[model samples]
Target: MPVRTADAALAGVRRGVGAERLTGRTALVTGSSRGMGRAAAIRLAQEGALVAVHYNRDEAAAREVVTSVEKDGGRAFAVRGELGVDGDVDGLFAVLEEDLRERTGSTDLHILVNNAGVMGGVGADEVTPEQFDRIFAVNAKAPFFLIQRALRNMPDGGRIINISSGLTRFANPDEIAYAMSKGALEQLALHFAKALGPRRITINSVAPGITRNGNPVFDIPEVVEQMAGLSAFGRVGEPEDVADVVAFLATDEARWITGSFVDATGGTLLG
Candidate 1:
């Protein structure tokens, strides 16, 4: 058979045999009001998992995501939470627990995607202690505690996917604090995988390169073009690109894949 034809056949087989992969599963995706998080939540729901659409401050945006998911015949609801704060995290869980009970009569969660993050690059000299602390609180500490809370409600075969960045591998001179925070997240994935292995829970990280959203960084045509050039694919990635991988990870098809960092970076880390 031709290579392309053979590849197509294999893909069909995988899809057909994947066991209704994520059907009846429940997922939580933080920072899902827009961008990558929103894409991931929708993808997971499309793949048959009930999704919890999480947002920090954008209630309307979060509701919009939920509405879109439901319109597509998927299960989803907006849940508000501030990633870097304790009270907000606790309250988020409380609401999630209640929602879960109403929907499925169970508090168990199957997948947790730590997709919330903030990016602000400052020179080392300009980085203040407060700035560093906030970055860590959101990018590192929040995920840690969220994972801890998730594991309590997750059963065997559950998954935890942390969203990291390419900066962890390549140095960005101006992103001192942001890079450091992602580095910490990378470590958390490895250690959490080990810690959760006994329960058959898998933990991993998905690191992305510069991608366009409504963010100002990608607003300039020249800057967008420059970002595309950084990748071997010669194009910046789309939210859907990252979402596809995350949806797969949440399925039983990836049960054996754990403690790994999957690069959805459009080959930006490639030399």
Candidate 2:
């Protein structure tokens, strides 16, 4: 089986997530310049939320996302700050709050999607202390702090979604450190859902497996087939697949659900 190109895979799969269920709401998706983050940003905007497209260094790509959202008749803006660095969250929120206050006359954020992460530190033997620290810093610490700051302005009944990975549930020795980092990320949802319950804020983690994100290896038929077979659906996961889940979590439909690990993995490795 040939690997499905991104265009082909998304051709029919892309559509509006809701009929303005999130109208008048504001969302911030981190690392949204490309991949799942880009897709999630677009999906949230489609639901009528004013989106904040956050990027680390790709200002051009981030601008494109803002343009895409605008072209779709939705409102969006781009914010830049490199995660895992000192003052990253503060710097990001500065620009974000400025935009929010200017646009809506308020700094209230309704949804926060912690989608930014690093994916190195391969295995135990190959992993170095530097890599482990960086991985945890980006994947775990950054989101932890971002949530800490977001809650201040996030109103009651807000939604917080952390983009996690299937490696947290399934074993992947090759990604030991990365998996550990994501595992720590999952704990954020579990713990915060309880702590923030009084405020009616719901926090959850969405785990995706072997998602295609424009990687060159996915262009190879053999590699695609091998990965596709791992999923119960007999196809590789697409960004839209997980983005839909993220959008749902942000909606009122998922209000009863919190402190959950949602499997957006195309049923990967389910015998």
Determine which window of 10 residues in candidate 1 has minimal summed lDDT. Answer: 1-10
| Model 1 lDDT per residue over 1-271, tens place | 1111112333423231234468888999999989999989988888878899998888999999999988877789988877787675778899999999899999999999999998767888888888888999999989888887887899887999999998988888899789899999988878888888888888899998876567786667677767777787676777777887888888777889888988888889577
lDDT against the true structure, each candidate: 0.83, 0.92
All-Cα superposition RMSD per candidate? 4.9, 1.9
**Runs with alpha carbons beyond 4 Å of true place in candidate 2:** 1-10
TM-score of each: 0.91, 0.95
lDDT of 2 at 45: 97
The residue-by-residue lDDT of candidate 2 on 1-271, one tens digit each, is 4545344546865477448889999999999999999999999999999999999889999999999999889899999889998998899899999999999999999999999988883667889889999999999999999999999999999999999999998988888899999999999999999999999999999999999887898888888888988888778888888998999999999999999999988888998
Candidate 1 yields a Cα-based lDDT of 0.83
In model 2, the clashing pairs are none
